[model samples]
Target: MFSIASDSAKSVRYVLEHDHADPNESIGPQSALAFALTNEHLTQKLEIVKALLAHGADPASLRNPELNPPHRDSSVGDDSMLLSPPPTTTLEAMDPATRYFISRADAPQTRHLSTLLQKSLFRPLGGVRYDIVGQDQVFEQLFTVLNLHSRTLSVSPLVILLCGPSGHGKSFLARRFGPLLGVPTHTVNVTTLRSTHDLWDSYSMSPYEEITTRTLAQFLLENEGKRCVVVLDEIEKVEEPKVLYSLLMPWELGERVAGTCSPRAGHRHIDVRQVVWLGTSNIGHDFVFEFCETSSGMSVSHGEYLELARLVRPRVSQSLGASLSSRVTTVLPFVPFTEAELMAIATEAFYSLGGERAYFVSLDIVEHVSRKAIECYIPEEGARSLHRAISSLLMDMPEFLEQSNK
Candidate 1:
């Protein structure tokens, strides 16, 4: 295959034969242009470099401090010509999202590459949907919740209930939609907060107040005037349900809950309606399904689904303050993506890599891995497994090139 070639002419002929555009034609984020620059193999590197330039990499895009082409000393070979000059173009001119796909080709340190990539690919706190397919309705609903809390709009108290079975993508939806709605999304992992003091110290605030007040204070200081999307992941795990009441009160009441902190010494209020609160849980649906089947001696015509908000209400009321509990809304269950959707997500991952040389193991690959993960009741990790599989596959390509040299 072209990807395993040792020489430039053969790779070029492979591209011409296949009528490919860039090495990225095979992968979504990985590109031949970026790959060529990263590979240590001098001759293959030159070929891919020429191929990238011939295809579309702006000659001017390669430059120092900008796209610090690997140092000559770090190159795979002693070929001084390859390291003597830097590539000459800004990442902006290349396929911006996938440009850094090859940034680690000759990585001695991946920190620079990771930092550059985090800036380039997606914003911090911004969400990425790895393999989600066909959730236009979900996206629309999220946007609706976000638009309601827009600073530009004067909206009423609003609470969004995002519930779903594990691996159904509720968390992914909230994270991705937060930025679009112009609200910063914050995820609360109650398990990470061992004690009330742990919670207070975690946010660098006083334990005299509930965790929500402190969290809101910090969020407001940094992102004032912006609506915030709060994701309460795995609400079932909270040791104290009262905590939920404190967290949801402001959003429910459309006012901020004042804390005993140095600032806001007295009770103060914030517009709660401006912040969208999303809670996800997997607790109730199974109970509901079993109840329906046994009690009625027949299942409902429609399928049963659990809502986290309903399941955790008693706890939320107990942990959170009474005032906060009144402002909450029940969560809705999220629909799972179909098989076709999973395939589409895989396709997108490949497309994002730059497609040309990117190789997807196949639907069988996803099924083999996902089914195994599902059997373990950890479908969420399936995407990660797929990533590892692809990483393993691509890792073999460079090694193949190395063997060809022998």
Candidate 2:
């Protein structure tokens, strides 16, 4: 009976006490202790958990007996200890498992929220550590922004603009840390977005006019009151002034409408203003050349970028809505990927598949293949070319063939 009840009972206790606990774990009638542990209130649930732990519950036991709370044959009147000292004192004498269970029950809500965030979001973000290195000031600024936004119980959104060249790991950093901070991410491919209409027509309409319409806004609404990190990738692709203006409007004020088109007939608008938006761009070799032609540095000059952004604000307002382009602040640069960084990313990928041997094979073959791909293709290319090059390298590898044969 003890064996049968233990598995379900432990699972029930876990779900009620642990922040990451899945409420769906299986339980049965024979596991009366498990069934009792499902009480919603923390106080009631913890009492049951305490009772089980105090009664010498073995945490390792999994199998449940057909009968639990096994009926005792002897009389209980001889045992007077139960009516004496309280279980509170008895609780102090138990193992860590018991202590941990009790302590978790008493833990504050913030700790529970942290645990839940870690389990659901951070765990899946590849556990990548932030590389502060030369960017201590930058990291401090980012952290300050994140903390400010997190402390907001209402709608105080903080926009973190990561401006650097391509391949600098901007997206990687955002993806990795966004979830852990309880901030949801929705990336916008700036290159793909040519016109105000382009953003609207591409994605489907469900919670909004179109799927892409205010993508960040929709994600924020879904996870209301939570910090949100919106990544606008490759914004340099949006050379048009109108598009740039539209993108910035949302960050300035409280709300910015992306469109006005609904299923009923007319246009539908996507209102998303209270979100932290990060825009990234890589303008090739002509960074200073193009921007200087107008008024700023191709990538680094904030003043020039802002001026250019302001010039195109009207197009977005006219097409989307005057209300849409009213909110935008800050234009950050995307750093280019250095040879060493690219190599590091490749090495990381190899180790992720396995380790040691796998890493060696992938690095050796992938580097050779990637170099050859660039040599065979045009001087300037994009992600598609890179993907093809990698695919070609994997296909040509002798080790890959051997593995497939096995």
Which candidate's TM-score is highest? Answer: 1
lDDT tens digits, residue span 97-146, model 1: 12332232222232332233243212222122221433333433343334
Model 2 per-residue lDDT tens digits across residues 99-177: 3443333335224333433433223221122221012223333443344444543353345545433444555565545
Give Cα distance to truth, residue 260, candidate 2, Å.
Answer: 4.9
Worst 10 residues of 2 by lDDT: 126-135
- Choose the strongest candidate by lDDT: 1
